[model samples]
Target: MSTATPAHSSAQSGTAAIQSATIETRDWLIAAAAAIVALIALYAVFMDNGSLISATGDYLHEFAHDGRHLFGAPCH
Candidate 1:
């Protein structure tokens, strides 16, 4: 009879792979949550029209930033 460790087909291999996948998925979820929170905070800060208008000028400043072609002169 052969005498080998018989580790070529071990259950631990599949378990390790599953654990690695779970860890990777958790990392992605955390990163996504952080990004979403950051976006929300930014939106709250910029959504105040009065503040934005006072900071710059004109309430339409935010929209104009998207494209300068609409305005008569190029944006600074």
Candidate 2:
């Protein structure tokens, strides 16, 4: 009185596992990229002394001046 079928094979399960791994890897890559970008932005705001964005003149420096002071970054 069994109603089991052989349609769901090991190959299909393997493919599904691979797809799940790929999605997890993609999510990790995205998170890593976002963290790197955030670190760069923090450097520009707190540690950069016009070297990171020298092409943009003093715009970034002036914009983040108060923030730098607030965070004790020694902008002076």
Candidate 3:
């Protein structure tokens, strides 16, 4: 919540725009939080210098990131 809001308040603005924005924010927050958690878990898994499974997960995540970057989305 910003201290300075736009001129269009809930009363003046329609409900649809507000609802959509709220939903989008919720989705973005969820995605961001999940990504962060994934990173932290990955770090923890590799903390002991990693077992085979941990190393495999790290490689898989790197591969997934590379693929996403190449295609511009999770699977293009």
By lDDT: ranked, best first = 2, 3, 1
In candidate 1 the C-alpha lDDT for residue 16 amounts to 87
Q: Which ten residues in a row have the lowest lDDT in candidate 2?
A: 1-10
- Relative to the true structure, candidate 2 reaches a TM of 0.78
Clashes of each: 0, 0, 0
After superposing candidate 2, which stretches have Cα over 4 Å from the reference? 1-7
- lDDT by residue (1-76, candidate 1, tens digit) is 1334446445677788999999999999999999999886554344434453466554454564444445333444
Model 3 CA deviation exceeding 4 Å by range: 1-13, 47-76
lDDT of 1: 0.60
By TM-score, the best candidate is 2
| Model 1: pairs clashing at backbone N, Cα or C within 3 Å | none
lDDT of 3: 0.61
Regions of candidate 1 where Cα sits further than 4 Å from its true position = 1-4, 50-76
What does candidate 3's lDDT look like per residue over 14-34, in tens digits? 677788899999999999999
lDDT of 2: 0.85
Q: Rate residue 75 of model 3 by lDDT.
A: 31
lDDT per residue (tens digit) for residues 1-76 in model 2: 1333344556688899999999999999999999999999888888877788669677788899999899889877
* Root-mean-square deviation per candidate: 7.1, 2.8, 12.3
